[model samples]
Structures are given as C-alpha cells and as structure tokens.
Target: MSSYLDGGGGCRKRRRGGERIFKFKSFGENGCPVEFDGSFRNNVKALVEYGNLEMNLCNDGVLCWTFQLEVHRHPPLNVLLFVVEEPVRASSINLHCKHCRYVGWGNHMICNKKYHFLLPSKDTVASCFNCDETNSYESNPEKGKLNLVELKGHIMHGVFHSNGFGHLLCVNGMEMGSDQLAGYQITEFWDRLCTGLQARKVSLCDTSRKRGMELRLLYGVAYGHPWFGRWGYKFGRGCYGVNKPIYQKAIEAIQGIPLCLLNHHLSISNNEVSVIFSRYQALSDHSIVTLGDLLHFMLKLRSRLPEENITSSCNPTTVETNCRWSPKRVEAATRVIVEALKNREFRWVSRQEVRDAARAYIGDTGLLDFVLKSLGNHIVGNYLVRRCLNPVTKVLEYCLEDISTVFPNSEALIMNNSKAKPRNKITKVQLMKDIGYLYKHILNDQKPTMSTGVLSAIPMATRIILDTKFLLKEYTEEQLPIRGNSFKLFCTVTLRNNEGIDEGSKKPMLPYECVSFNENTTFDELRQEVEKCFREVYWRLRSFVVEAVANMSVKGSDLVVGSVEMGQKLVFIGSNDDQIGSEDSSGTGIVDCLCGAKEDDGERLISCDICEVWQHTSHALANADADALLNNIEKWVVIMMNLQRFYLGILHIFTCPVVRNNVKVL
Candidate 1:
C-alpha cells in the first residue's frame, strides 16, 4: 500500500481565490484518492472560430470540444472475478457504486468482504456509527459506512481483494440495491496484493527438497528482510510452499534483512546455515502493520530479483517453404494482377517479396483473406450488375427529398420521374430496389449506404475543383500540351470564356462539353474570326431574352486560352430580365411578371455595345512532327460575334445615320 501522509486542513471550509469548493467526503481505504478536485471552465473559442472547417473533405466539421483536468492520488485498478460455484440471491460482495447499478448482459455482483477482513484504523472506528457504544453493535454500520464484506457473509470464489472501493452492496457477484463499500482505496491496495502474490508464487517454487529444507531451517530463526520485518525462512525455499504459520513468521523476520543482501541468497558454511536479512522493511515505526503493506514490501523485493538462467540442449531452427502464390506478394504483383484483371499485363512476383512482407506482418491473416475474397468475386457475374444498379439506386434515393421539392409538376422532368416521390409515401419495394441499385451500381458495393456514398463524393468534388483550377492556370500560360490537330483547344477557350459570365456553370465543366475546331488558321486570323462572331452575336440579342448561361469550362487540350487577359475580355450580352427557360424545362418554367405597374422610360433600351480587339496567340505542339494547331476557333467565333454586335450596333449605325436618327427621333 502507498504511504498516506496527513493532508493538512482536515475538513476546513476555506475556499482559495477563484476556486469553488464542494463538500469533500472520502469513505474508502485511503480517503479520497483524487488529490486535486476543481471545477473546470467551459471554453468555446475554437468552436466559434473554425468549428465547421474540416481537416479533410472526407472528415466531418468539428462541432464541439471539451477537456477536463483533474489531480488524482490513487493508482488505477484492474478487477476480475473468478467465479467458482453456482450463485445465490443475497450473497454479500464489494462492488463499485457505478457497477452495482449496471444493467447489461455481462453485469455481475462483486463480493464485499473488505471491511470484515481488514481491521479498521482508529479514524475508521471514529467515523463508523456502528462502533458507537449507544448502538450495541447489533445492526450494521450506518448505510453510508456499510462494509460490503460484513453485509451477509456470502461465499465468493477467486475474488481478488483491494481496499478503498465504493460499493452499494454485492450478491451473486451482483449489486443488492445498495453500496456495501464506500470510498475504499481499492486500486492501490488490490494491485499491491496481486503483485506480491505473483512474486511469492513464482519465487518460492523448489526444484529440489534439499533447498527447501535448508530454507525452512534457516527461517526457523528470526532474520529480517524488508517485507517480513524480522522474518525467518520457515516458509521454505520457494515462497509458495510456505504454510500460513510459516508465512507469518517469515513476514515478522523480514525487517532484519539488510537491503543490500536481499537480492542474493545467503551462503551457508559447513557448520551452520547462514541466513541474510535486510533492514529495509514494509512497516516502519510510524504506521500500524497491515496485510496490504506487508504484501507490497514482499512484492518490491520480488521485483528486484534478477533474471538469469542457463539452459542448454535446444537447437535453433529455420523454416523454408515456397510461397509463389501467397497473398504476401500482393503489392509486389499489384501491376500484374491489375493488368490481369483488365487483361493488360501478366507477370509473376519474385519469391523474396512475399518473404519480406510476411516477416513484417507476421499474423495478418485477414489481409490474405480479403485478397482471396476479392479475387474470387472478380469472376462473379453479378459484380457488374451490382456495380451499376447500386449507384443508380443510391443516388436517386439520396436526392429524393431534394428532388421532391421539384414535385408533381417537378417530377415530370426526372429521368425516371414516374417513380420519384416524397419519402414517407415511397413504398418498401421501391425503396429496397433503389437502395439495392445504389449499393450495387453507384457505390459498387464499396459504400452500400446512401450516406457513405454522399460522404465519399465530397472529397472527390473538392479534388475536381482543385484539378480544374490547376488546368486553367496551365492553359492560360500556354504551358499545357495538345495531343493532335483537333478543335479541343478552341472549344476550351470558348467554354472558359462562357463560364466566367455564367453563374449556372460554376461547377467544373465536363470534358464532353467542349467543341473541337480547325487548326490551319494563324493566331491573327483566329482573332479576326472571333471578332466577326462577336459582332454577329450582339445584334442577335435584340429583345428581353433572359437566357440561362450554363457550364462553360476548359479541359484537356483546351488550356491554350487560359490567359487572364483572355478571361477578362469575354463578355455576356443578354437581357437583365428574369425570363429564363430551362434547357430541360418540362418540370419547371419561369414566369417574368413586373409587379410594379409604373413603366420604365424607354431610355432603358440604349443600343447594346459590341467591342473588338485584335490579339495574337501562339500554339506550341508537344509533337512537332504532328504539327497540330489545336485551334481556339469556337472561342474566337463567340468573341467575334459579341464584338461584331457591339461594332454593328455602334459603328455600323454611323454608317446608316438615318436608321439611328429614327430611333432618336422617337
């Protein structure tokens, strides 16, 4: 047991500055084991600042955080009960207050025999109401001071003892509706006893009877070792073989053993057996000797015993086996297997690779099992069907609520609108089919749940945005490569310009959206062509045609137009009104109604401007032999269209002054 020094201030009610004091009561062995008891202030600064930001896209944003600091004086406890017989109802046992109320499959009662076994100290008697002369000792102590061990003398088997445990009551290794032990210092006392028991059991085993007799005779006289204070070896050579009487005698003589001589066995002369004892002892003059204290001392000596033994006759061995087909070679043969799956490449891994990983992951049988399972499934017919159906089902179900917002009329535009409906109304059969499809197709059995599929996609979406941004920067700098003489570059330039003005196109554009154009023209020719297209497009938007601009983006081979100058030059010329119609507009329609009847002045219809500027672009083909221009013709066309409109509406009007004057005359 640990030495407990008197904590000053006995039950003083003084409160330190800024510290709140609560009633402190200790009923267990060493009183309250927790040394520092203070309430903590809850802080929320982190939550306020960046709580919703995630470490990674796949991670959840932190919502809340809390931490508490406490000073404790006792060691941690490890408790296990070895039941030896059928249980009874009213069996007495010691149990923690919390465990006594546990209701679960493994819940059991802890026997409380602590109070009866260990004699109470003076303070305990003074605190215990049962010991009072007025009580006649007929009844148990007050409920608060009830000792589980003295409750009902229950028969317990293989129960480990510890002091300072808080218990309500124990029966059949189960709580009996009340605590039997309260505030007991069980952790420190129990661990010390266990350590001592282990040391004694292992240290006292005799290989020969001579050694045992020698120890017994030597212990017949009192000697001292730290644990048994003035002990004799009457308990025999091996500590385990000692009887209770010999055990007690040896304990008494242990204190005489010198600390320096405790580690080595005493050498006996031919005339007499020499027994060395250590002056170092468990119980000093200051405190009363307790069983726990003695055991603790014994354990300290046992622990200091050296580990040295000579053994001969065993031969070293090595194992040799062919592992050519082992899963241990999975990584080494990864490319081989991957190509094999897609019928791409096939190669065997060296035997050495298998040996290396196997040595490292000695007992990882599960990895092998998983590999085999995956390999076996590769040949299954349902894999493809499952993959396809699972995702489709999952996505549809996941978006159901969002989809429902479009409803009745909104449902008409869904790919499978006939089945789309609000959740509660969705039938079990439909739900199962959708869920099954999603699990099979979209998630590919990797993430069978709807939530998981959505979660995995979040990181992917973030990654796409980052990738698009990188590609855009590279394209503008004309540092990216073009594969061939295709219209890919031109299409990207067009879409990139389009995307800057279109709010609907905020999502990264897909590869299929770009249009390829001819590459034979010079950069100057392309600039002129673009200007022409712009002029043509300006005049086309004469009415309040509020058209929705959808996704316009640059992708592979189209990065040639990623210049900041090019980005700023692109312009959208459409009505500021809200008369937009859906591209796939069956379910939803837009209605533009000017609620305020007061008409705006016709001055609002000022002539739309079309602007033009000549810019040159240089194309560098990665493969000079192919000489692919990878034209930016479409973007050139759109740009020219807008510019042409601006020029025609302005410069061409100068060419036809009467037509412009008629509008002014009105």
Candidate 2:
C-alpha cells in the first residue's frame, strides 16, 4: 500500500457537488502533471456513488475509497486496511475463527467451514472470491458447526509502472475474513477500478498480450498466503525488489535439512517422504515456498525451538557426502528408460537412443550408463557400446536369399528392392520347419518329396529350387486317398528345459510338425503318434507329462479338441514330472464326458453318478434344481460318498437324463 510517487506537490480544487479533489502535481516522463483527467475523475465519482464508496484523499493527494453501504437495513461493514512493505508479523495480527469467536494468534488456523473459490478469468486484472460451506464433521452432529457468512471487506492494492502497465495485488481472505464476497459484486468493483485506471492510461497487463507486464509479489506476503493460488495467482517471479536475497536464503536453509529428519519430525510416512523430497528438491535458491508447503516445517520448529535457533536447526553444520549414482537417481533413470522403451516401436534399441531419450530426466551420462548396464536382460552388447544389429537390414538380407529378385550390393538398392519385392507371407518359424523336413529326408538317403502345402509355405527362392529339382509334387499325385476323409494336422511341441543340459548345447527344434491323418485314426492312435514324434524329436516322453491342446486359429486360443480327425493346429506342452501316473483300474483319469461344449466356455460341468458322464449343470438341471444342489451341496456329497461314486475333482454333480430318469435326492 506504499505510494510509488512520494513528496509530490498538491493543489486543492472543488467540484460542483462540493466534493473536494486534490490534484497531484507529479510529472510524468512527458513533463505533464501526473493527475487524473476530467473524464477519469467523473468516472471515479460515478463509481463511488454507485458502489456507495466513501472517497478519501491521502496525504500524498492520491485518491482512495472505503466500501461501506447498507442496502436493506444491514449492519455497516468495516473495511480494514494494513500497509506493509514486507509480510505482516504474526505477532502483530490476531487469528480467529468467526464461529467460536476465538481471538488467539497461531501459526495454523483451524476452521470447521471449508471454503471453495471461483477463479477469475485470465484477462481480468481483478479476481472474485467466493466460498461454499461444507461441514467438516457432518457425521458427528453433536459437534459445533461453523456457518458461512458475508465477509467484512476485500483486501487489495494497485501499483502502476511508468511503462504504461499496472499490477493489482490482492491479499488472501483467510486473515481478513473477506473471502465470501459474491462473484458479481467483486466483478463490479474490479471493472470500475480497472476502467478508471485505463482512463488514466494505466493499462493492466494481460496474459494474452505479447509483451505483458510482470506482476511481482512480496516474498513474505506471497509466502504467507498460499490460498492466493486459488484466485489464479502464480508465485514464480521470486519476490519484489530487495527482498529476493532474503527469500533465496530461506529456500537454501529449508533445502539444507535432510529429508529423513523432516519426515521424522513431521510424522510423514515413508511412502510420502519421496513425494515431499521431490517437491523439496524442486525448490531452488530463486524460488519461494507456499505457506501450505512450509506450514508443518514452520509450526514444528517454532513450537520446539526459539526463533533464532530455528534457522540453525534447519541448516545443520554437518554435511553428508553422497555417491554420484545414488539409488534414487538410478531408479529415476531406470523409470525414464523403461517409459522410453515402452513408447518405442522396436524391441532392440541403441545405447545412444536410450541416452537421448533419458537425457531430460538424467542429466549425468555416467549415471545413465550405470543404470543401463545394470539392466541384465535389456542390455545387448558391451557397457559402452550397447548396440543391436539393425533389424531392417537383417530382414532385407533374409528376404534377398529367399526371393528371385536381384539388386545391386549398395545400401540404397537393397532398401529399394526390399520395398519392390512381393511381401513375404510366410513366417521365419515356418520356413525353418520346411528346411528341417527337407534335410531329414536327404539324411535318410530317400528322395526329398514335399506336398503342395509345404511347397507353398516355403520362401519364393526355396520354392523355385524345389520346382527345378522336381522334388515338389501335387497332393493327389503324391499318394492315394485313405479309407475316409483325410486332413493334415499342424503340431507344435514345446519341451521343458532340462536341469543338467545347457541351452546352447541343446539341439534346435523345429517350430511345428505336420502329420497326415484320416477319419479312421482313433484318439488312442493319434496320442501314440504324437508321443512317438515327441520321443524322436527330443527324447522319450517318460520324464515329461505331455498335454495336447488344439489351437483354435480363428478364436486365437487353445482348446481341447475331442477328435484329431479334423485338421487343426495342436500344441503339445510338456512339463517335467518325477512321478508317472499309475494305471487306474476304475478309469478315473479317462474323460468320457458327453458334453460337446469346451471346458473354457465358462459353463459349470457336473458328472453323473451311474455313467460318470460330465454334463453342463446349466443344460442338465433346472435353475431351481441347481440352486437346491448348491444350497445342500454337503448333504449331496455325503450321499455320493456313501454310494462310492463321489468325484471330488468335479465341482458340481447331477444325474443326466440319459443315465437315469430322475435325479436322486439326498
């Protein structure tokens, strides 16, 4: 509230309404008296009348006003004004809640009423303050409640620069009790004030302007009122004028305190310590701390130590040395690398690419390299030169060996030819399997013969070689048809990693094997053939449990196919097992289920007692019957146990109509 211009000559004048006006003789850069023009003067007079504002002239001949109006017999509200170059000392101001009328001053204020603010528009130089009342302890009705009431007055001040821009500073409402003003009322006041200032050619700075004015707040004032952010005020401009050095010193003092000590003193959780430390680390020598952030720091220290000792405790004399690649920095760098890799299109990435991606977060190169090397599976080559062969070039070279197309040895020709060639539809796994099949026939000293399916699945160049050698033949010409319908079944066998065998020493297995079968092939015959093939490929299936599952290519999921007569892709997953299954004389391992639906169809299956046929509970039982079975499951289980026909493996049980006319009731 201090005047920018001081010791200016004053000339007294009178208007027609007998209202005295003191004109300041302060000169502008143009040598003209820095006085309000007649139009601005009249505008101020009209605003004062409309708002019922009481006008007053300061000793410096500057105009000011106090808002005091009663529209409907309301009590006269007093407007409190305080002028200070720095923050108002806590000792000088009294803090109180309007509800309890408690007049005690403290570092923290507790109120039962929660206030909500409506932010101002970005273009408006003024701000509107309002609040909605929320009961803090609504669950406990017996507790005393605070009510929302109209605030006494708004606390604001204006400062104008000689560069034709102005800044309007407003104090937070918590201390002055002026936060509950209506939106329209605050808007009207700001509009009139801004208009008068604009008439005097004092343009308020707006963010939309290319070269807007800077609004600087006092370090102490802004730090004391964190709630000003709710009114759209940002506090990143440091402090006003000479107070910046003091603000920087305070920031450094706070930063000097160990995060662990702060967490312990504040009773903050370990999980929250990282967050608080991150925010603390963000504070630099040139920044100010909001009151909300430093509230606990100030209260705890002030309560335990004297004012002079507080600074000493915050800034301890001892300093602890830390490693450059600390655990926290390593973790941060790892997170950045992981996030970058997730966004990347390819699995393989170079060290330089990773370094560039994480440069923003991890400025230190040595720390990033350490973290990269620590990633056991992610790192490809040497610690310094972590690079992978370019996948695009590898794909192009692989295609060149398969296709008949020829191109120059230059990089440009390879790239262009790769695009020009027909897109290869076969996967690398399929191509490898075809080559293995051909090699096996040759090793046996037999003529290498391939069906149309195998020939079509190989690369174009390999297909041309087979055609020229007269090794590929039509499906009908290669062999006569079997008794019934015939189809080829594609099978994949995945062997469990043996304990004693090294991965590199193990033989390379084909991706999948194809076997021809007819409708005459029984389930037992198909199972035997698969087991024989597994033994020939790896070893005997004695040490492994082979579970065959059909991969429904259309559905993109593996399902247990009932028959191998139809063509389908099968996956044989083998796991090492120490104990082989003993033959069950009662046939417990056998699945003689009548239900055609797959187990993964999400329906509950129940087994019958007599035939031991698995049937879907939904299809076999009525809703009420199923509910009754569920309600009395224990009794039914006891009945089944007594009959020696209980199957604990099955979750639900009910007799199928085909086995029995009526379901036996327990």
Q: What lDDT score belongs to each candidate, Candidate 1 first?
A: 0.23, 0.29
Q: Assess candidate 1 and give its TM-score to the true structure.
A: 0.14
Q: What are the runs in model 1 whose C-alpha is more than 4 Å off?
A: 1-145, 151-189, 196-337, 340-666
Top candidate on TM-score is 2
Question: Alpha carbon lDDT of residue 421, candidate 2?
Answer: 29
For model 2, what is the C-alpha lDDT against the true structure? 0.29
Q: Write the per-residue lDDT of candidate 1 for residues 368-479, one digit (tens) a residue.
A: 3333223321111111000001111121000001222212233222111224323112233332343333223222223233123212331221111111110000001122
Could you give candidate 2's per-residue lDDT for residues 211-307 as a string of tens digits?
A: 1111111112223322222233322221011122232332222222233333333333223333323222221111212222343333233335443
Error of 2 at 450 (Å): 82
What's each prediction's TM-score?
Answer: 0.14, 0.18
Query: Which runs in model 2 stand beyond 4 Å of their true positions?
Result: 1-43, 49-195, 198-244, 251-271, 275-666
